[model samples]
Target: MTPEDRFPGPELPDSGPRHQPDLDVLPYGSYYEPEPEPGFEPEAGYGYTTTSGYGGARFLEAHWPTASQQAHPGEPVHPQAPAAEDPPTIELGPPLDKFGKPIEELNFPYPQPEPGEAPGPLYVVGDVHGYLDELLAALHQQGLIDAEGHWAAGRSRVWFLGDFTDRGPDGIGVIDLVMQLAAEAAAAGGYCRALMGNHELLFLGAAKYGDEPVQSTAGTASFLAAWRLNGGQQQDLERLQTHHISWLSRLPALALEDGHLLLHSDTTAYLEYGESITEVNDAVHHLLTEEGADEWWDCFRRFTKRFAFRGDAGPQAVHELLGAYGGQRVVHGHSPIPYLTGSTHLDDGTPPHVPGPYIYADELAIAMDGGVTMEGRLLVARLPLN
Candidate 1:
């Protein structure tokens, strides 16, 4: 069965009256099959093909929790059965570089920057929930990567606003690509970094604690159960490696670059961590390493909070975070643009059109998640969006 058949459009609530009449129409545009990359074949059971362009078949829409559903911090927003049974174990083969060569056989030399050289342009990517092909295409479109998917933007920085895994297919693949780009970008005097999204915490919690029960506001729950309920993929867990875990665990929860406070979720729960960016990041890292499952679960719960930067008090929330984090504005990913703008048409069987990042909070915040999971665009845009 296709993605559309397996996961039908969510029954969303009406977003008030609309002038447009309901018509039988496909939510996305024309579809075209792109040639698969060399030595990078699409894996089976991932529910995605090598096809390109926006369409229901290519983009699988996962259920996003509503505010009422996410009322309890620890409780899952959308509790549902697993999409499919546990996938059988399969060999992933040896790790390869962008050129399809074994990484161990390659010697990547670091290129030193000359004196007085300024940093390259800054770019930020929205949440890529396991959509590897879409991520690759977006990066390529922005000239960050070459045709072979290698980092080609010399000295140009890239920041991925987290949620690397879960929901869609090939979450592990997305993580692997980001990790590879980090190394390659560093070697070229540039850097590609990522933030720790709530999904990362969920994924790691599931990996480490599994079915072990944890205390929640809504009673007892397990990380694995919550993870699956929140669009966790079995193949991602199966394909996860030790290195990937370490890298993800080490990702900072917040970043301040070019006067933009980069984060995964727009919630002000970050203030609960610390007063400064360093303190907040260190606190999060400490929690993952030294804290128990309950503490970790609480941290995950807080990070999952969204829309703090909305409503009349939204500007104040942004100000609170900016006052503490020391950035002119906030850039985040967790809350999709459609939800932020209240323009989603899921209730009408239509795909939400996310043109780009949604700038809101009285122009103090920029939401980067283009709602790719809902057949929206996978956004990759330069910093200081105009």
Candidate 2:
């Protein structure tokens, strides 16, 4: 299916009373014009290609669903309203070639480590915002998966940094692939796990509380509205089965492997959840399971915060998280490396080239998100970078 078909334009609503939230108090970050870098011009519709830092008025003005689109209890629906103009077609980079057959040629054979051998090489994947084909290509390139997309690295541990859905054509497809690999990996004496991302929270929230009004700092909002504003795919929503919800809800928010504190977001807001690693994971799990709509929204908002590990105080921020969580370095996937480095555009204005994971914050933080949504690479790298 086309990207437009996957993420349909917002339906226009008839003139009727709508409870619009005050954009000034969006509960998230404030709206501001991003400074132009070389070869980067702000687009008319959405300012940025990647969904890293867009929030507040820009999000509402450009892509908020109308009253009819989000039918609340006792709210009127006008089915005869004229259809709105189609939104500008989003450029999702070049199409990837399909993997026709399982790769029989194994250039890098799976390593056969002894039972007690320090668990095979640990690999970490960056944010995968849909873009299933790109994900498959990256995995295959890393020898993590075969041409058939099954786990090929025997006894190798893989941890995905979440964000399996939204923005692209096949979010559900991405989730299905990850889940399938998890099972296949376990059977092959390896393990493939994932961390919960802000998008995961947003996806689950939208599924659980569709149009239900939740209290927000701005006024009143709903999960469905926020999800759509942040590139929620209609096909993904339609294919969201109960099993998907269960799996997403159970994913831990943080993990530490090979002295790398792996997380989804770059914010220190995780400190609000708990001090210790186990405490943080348990607290997030509890919140996802036992919390109400407002609580869930609050949790989602906090995780959405980014850029904590940037600027002059960036190292201190990473230090705080490391002190609480216990890790030699922080490896995360929320803020794209291009944005983090302030070099999102090249002299020629082409998409930023992300050679590999960016190690910054005095080598205390490593950024893995290759901004695939913006025609960037889907990163799959081995840990403990040299």
Candidate 3:
């Protein structure tokens, strides 16, 4: 019924920094392909009449209201990413030790961050389901952390929207760094806090008690089978632990600071908690901590399952989530910008990608999920990357 109820409270163990390898980095310029924008391709499954396109890129035709409609000062325009300011390329170098291989530890581009210093610039990383290269490049662009995954600037925080595991080769490695960097950044005044992702829950079940069979909305599913299909990388299993589960389990359902609400998925199911923002959040956290049950878990599963921001009435959904969550807009990572931007091409087998950085929906929600699992872009945005 709530996040806390599912997993009782205790300070979540901090996952210290992880040493990892970087392989299959995304080739540079994939996002820069000069093809005519995929806008309004009537033939494409994502016909112009509707908005979603390949890889979750949002088409502006629908989200923008007719000229007669007045706009809110809070609206963040869906502007195109600034002309490609190509970031310097990073080459995978030899590892300093045996912790991870050279390819795994791509060349880091920075002086290690100093503790207690706030990196003037801040970046919020979207889901990084492996694809270390893309992750590195995005960081390079933002200059938040370096290729080495060390803090580039001290005192600057990086909030991950969750789903760091599964669907890729280096889920474990990603968590390791995230956990480590969380402390490293905090030590320097910047912080790295992650949210509870569904994949994280599944991984917890698989590693702690595999094949034992757990209840799933998908029905009688084993954590292992479901995890694998969802991009569970076998190697990440070795890195699972009680700490990761606890931290993830206890992570807040929604975080609001400034004017944006950060959540993993785009549904307003959280509204079930209560009418007021704090009331709903407190209720959700409370249920997750102590009152968990069969139905409680099911509620978490279902709330996490809905992806309402991508539908035709997506703007309305945005209003609902913001209304209940108490934010001007929702900044989320689960829908995979690529999938939200456009429909996936199952036959071709290409990597997922966000058409570009920064998207605004009817000036309501800011979609931060730049899909990286499929050799796509991994985005890092400030609270206002819109």
Put down candidate 3 lDDT per residue, 60-162, tens digits, no spaces. Answer: 2232222234232112234334322211111112222224322243333334544432233335677777655556555555555666667655545467877
| lDDT by residue (tens digit), candidate 1, 4-35 | 35432222223222232111111132111223
Deviation in Å, model 3, residue 217 alpha carbon:
4.5
Give the TM-score of each candidate.
Answer: 0.73, 0.72, 0.65
Give me the overall lDDT of model 2. Answer: 0.67
All-Cα superposition RMSD per candidate: 17.6, 17.6, 14.8
Per-prediction backbone clash count: 0, 0, 43
User: How much does candidate 3 score in TM-score?
Assistant: 0.65
Best by TM-score: 1
